[model samples]
Target chain A: MKRVGLKDVAAEAGVSVTTVSHILNNVQGKRINAETRRLVLEVAEHLGYQPNDLARGLRLRRSNTVGFVSDEIATTPHAGQIIRGAQEAAAQNGLMLLMLNTGNDRDLEDKEIALLLRHQVDGVLYASMYHRVVEVPQRLASVPTVLLDARSDDPAVPSVVPDEEQGGRTATRELLAHGHRRIGFVNNIDDIPASRGRLAGYRGELAEAGIDFDPSLVVTEDSVAAGGYRGSRTLLGLDDPPTALFCFNDRMAMGAYRAASEAGLAIPADLSVIGFDNQELISENLFPALTTVALPHYEMGARAIFHLQQVIDRAEPLGAAVHEVLHCPLISRDSVARPRT
Target chain B: MKRVGLKDVAAEAGVSVTTVSHILNNVQGKRINAETRRLVLEVAEHLGYQPNDLARGLRLRRSNTVGFVSDEIATTPHAGQIIRGAQEAAAQNGLMLLMLNTGNDRDLEDKEIALLLRHQVDGVLYASMYHRVVEVPQRLASVPTVLLDARSDDPAVPSVVPDEEQGGRTATRELLAHGHRRIGFVNNIDDIPASRGRLAGYRGELAEAGIDFDPSLVVTEDSVAAGGYRGSRTLLGLDDPPTALFCFNDRMAMGAYRAASEAGLAIPADLSVIGFDNQELISENLFPALTTVALPHYEMGARAIFHLQQVIDRAEPLGAAVHEVLHCPLISRDSVARPRT
Candidate 1:
């Protein structure tokens, strides 16, 4: 059987096609009476006259859809929060989110971008699992793109990222204000933009205090749980361990705490430690509440959507790169205290 | 300029449309020579030939896509982990994931499901932020859906959920094995299936040990960090607080730890606590380590996809309810100990 169309519905309801379209689209405050609107809808429903999303998408030249292409979803906990913010903003702006998991494959990322383009998505949000510099795939250059939780060295794309440098500095400053002169740094091995930015912040604060940056005091390891554990072992094994330590993220902080405990050292007494990302588990689980910096995950997501909308509405070529940095605030929990003599 | 089609490419390459179709679809493998394959690809690229995803979707009656509909992506950290698992499975099967955030809005859920149907998605995986008895929307009865971390009273619909009963039992068994005769239970409101399952498991274990189940030892509250704290305070206020405590989840366990600390109690020495859902932060950050259960988030996601594939391939009725139950394993850390005199 042939599918029903708007003309059939209009003829069946004895109304004009324009009236039917207006009622179907739910045009607000239209002069149509409730009974006429109700009659048109009933006729359309009886005829199973479903609107063709593709045709509508073509005519409007807008899919009312946005694509969020990310590498991995599960491993990066922070990305989940960011997606939430973007989803909320997109919904508020009358758009639906079309998520594409690239599975961290370069080739697959290229394919997914092309697929989104075919679907006629208005814009795309390229979210990374970690804070790393990503080379935008060639296919996505034509599409309006915004990067989240990552940065690009090329100044052609817009990026919304956490202020990792400020977070690091704020965490260290809190430790310094508590009189921790002999401080240690736990760094991750990955050379991502976030890791580098955080390290720069830690160094800047230490230099401001006129303390010699001690290479011997820095322990580098993976950013994961096991990496934190191993880093802690090496740091504590040193002959002259620092009285306080700063960790890149909460996972490493936990590992550092465990190492200190094994050595029979007390938190905030023998060793004061601060961490970044203010993870929910870290702040609540530690014996001494973790004093850390909270990454602006939700805000970054919302802003990315807002920015994408701007690019789409202006129809302006996103020639120059746009970078929006949200500051990370320090939460003074029980983890940090004055170093005891 | 006119868009190029398979026929246009065939004419340009001096070959039959059938041969061009086979070459473009990469079906020539052993039948075609390497030179021919390279020539076809080069010509296709030069022509800017793009596959019509909509036509392909209709021809195969499969979109090579799956819809992941979740209540809220940001509210619960666990949802991200589940998505990761499903994504991996989808990638392995050469399928793409189309994500929709319902935000726990029933109306939105209905609309999203309708949209997914319009897209002709292969199948859908419905994930709730937390485990609870969800009413399967009537509109989704025709779609092949597998629920993750959530269940419906309707057994016909297959669901993949964590074994909350096992999680609770294992946590209780760990404390009991540690020789704690007097144990307490900290749980969320029992209206949720997870909470009920856990409470049942806890009671079953105590009965198995010939120990009388003490109603006074059970404390119920919200499952958030603050709720855990408040619940722990009440549990500790009892005249004879149990030597060990088992929390419904890690967030609540964090609260219990805080309350125990404020009451001048030492973990394992004075009070040992166990939690469920071994969330990354909760297990790692809990002082002395939190002995908890690891929810099979990744496995559930994989299974949901596997089940969805079966339904999609069969072209089975979309609204039929399917059910599945996944198991949880216990991760024994260092928090439990023997009862103290």
Candidate 2:
């Protein structure tokens, strides 16, 4: 005897497969004749149809579900936007998004990925709170996987990251456009990819403008307000101070604001400031409303899912990995002004 | 012939269950004999065993998994700690946690919960970004469900929430201990539960101290910095100004700090401030650092999972619903000080 399926019951009962599904799953949107509903149920019972989606998933190897494994993105201020982007993108492609937060622990990540595999997730999306290169777990390599705001050492693993260098260039060029010949950059330590990329962009922009790179004006420290405070103080205390200040991130820019206030300097009128990662909590509510660059967090998330969908549609692990770097847009606010020449 | 299982294969191959599992799952770390692993694989192949956990889950009616459906918690800044608490609690009892971010959309939440049900999740954990009363989805009532950082009107559903009243009392008590009798209050609007509970705590603490409640000193507004700033200004402009200010939240407290600064009033020496909700980004980074009450987010999550475990262990819907209210602790920092008399 052939194994009973939903189609067999649908054919025998003279009902559509959707009708059989609605009756078995108890989905209540549609209305059907009572007699037809009873007939469909009877035929399903007669054929011994199990309505076992688990069995179907196992046989077809497509659960129509994707696992999202994250290090810290899910619990950050950026979590809302990133999830909105990924969740909507996944839904567009008829797949469910199952999320897991590993808290940057390799052991916990291993456990979570194993669990996802046991559940037979069709593909995996590994995202991080910040943009950087990361190691892909061996368990994930077997599935069609995409990294969001992160990268794996393995060339085979595809990734989508923000263009930090372009963001830095945009910030510097904006100050330059305001006729500031001497600019100071309050940067983060170079160990981070974001810091490195942004610094390169800053230097590249200055060089392009025929302005001699001033080592005295560049200060690097932790990506915090205190770091920004100290960096701003040092730049202002220089023999020839910069009229414009560019910070690596919004937090650092907030620190610069405090330092400028303590120094009795009014924003834009005396010192212009620009920041990166337009964190709304800081930038929007700040006294002067900071001008900054928005990290492509939401876009990165959406693109990762779109790429994962393409990868999962293929029969096997993708042969050629795609590394897509998206651009960061500048958010101009009240913080920028022409230098007092 | 009896249906082949992992136990049967382990007994026939004369190996521990762990070894058989490691070989099948391809989990790294355990050093098993290569020949023994090969023998176990060969025996399992001869018995025609299908490694179908989904089928097993269906037969057992318990997937050994819990579905955590969240409206906004999974995509908020507090997502990390809450998830950590829930995930750790679930792992302690041999259960996998599969998460879904519903983005606060009812239709999407309905779809996600349906998918979780299809996967035979043993229990469900519905959480929110912040504490509030929520409507329990009708489909969730069928399973052993618990609300984390939220409450439901339905008595049958268990819930865990932070005790905001205790937090408010704790904040007020700190100021009272510093010899500040005439205190100003910047409160959130009365409609929100957090605001109501916190205000009640503030009044309760003042009553305990025998300080007459001065309606003139209390100003309610939105739970933001601007609200705190305006409230502080109003209180300070009064005939007898308050020596200290207790804000409903950290954001409001930041506004109070600005008001004090504008008046050339040094923190601690001239005007003391205390805030609720120890949001590190706002509280810790603020100059002098804010002293605020820490909401019991992690504990609420852990307790809810523990409650769900008990419900699942009972093998039926719980008869009595548990509403656990955990306490909030005050984090003392430099912002609080003795009044200048």
Question: Which candidate gets the maximum TM-score versus the true structure?
Answer: 2
The whole-model C-alpha lDDT of candidate 1 against the native structure comes to: 0.79
DockQ values per model: 0.26, 0.29
Native contact fraction per model: 0.34, 0.25
lDDT of each: 0.79, 0.82
| Regions of model 2 farther than 4 Å from truth | A1-38, A41-52, A73-75, B1-38, B41-52
Worst 10 residues of 1 chain A by lDDT: A52-61
Q: Give TM-score values for chain A, per-prediction.
A: 0.87, 0.86
The iRMS of the candidates, in order, is 4.5, 7.3
TM-score, candidate 1, is: 0.77
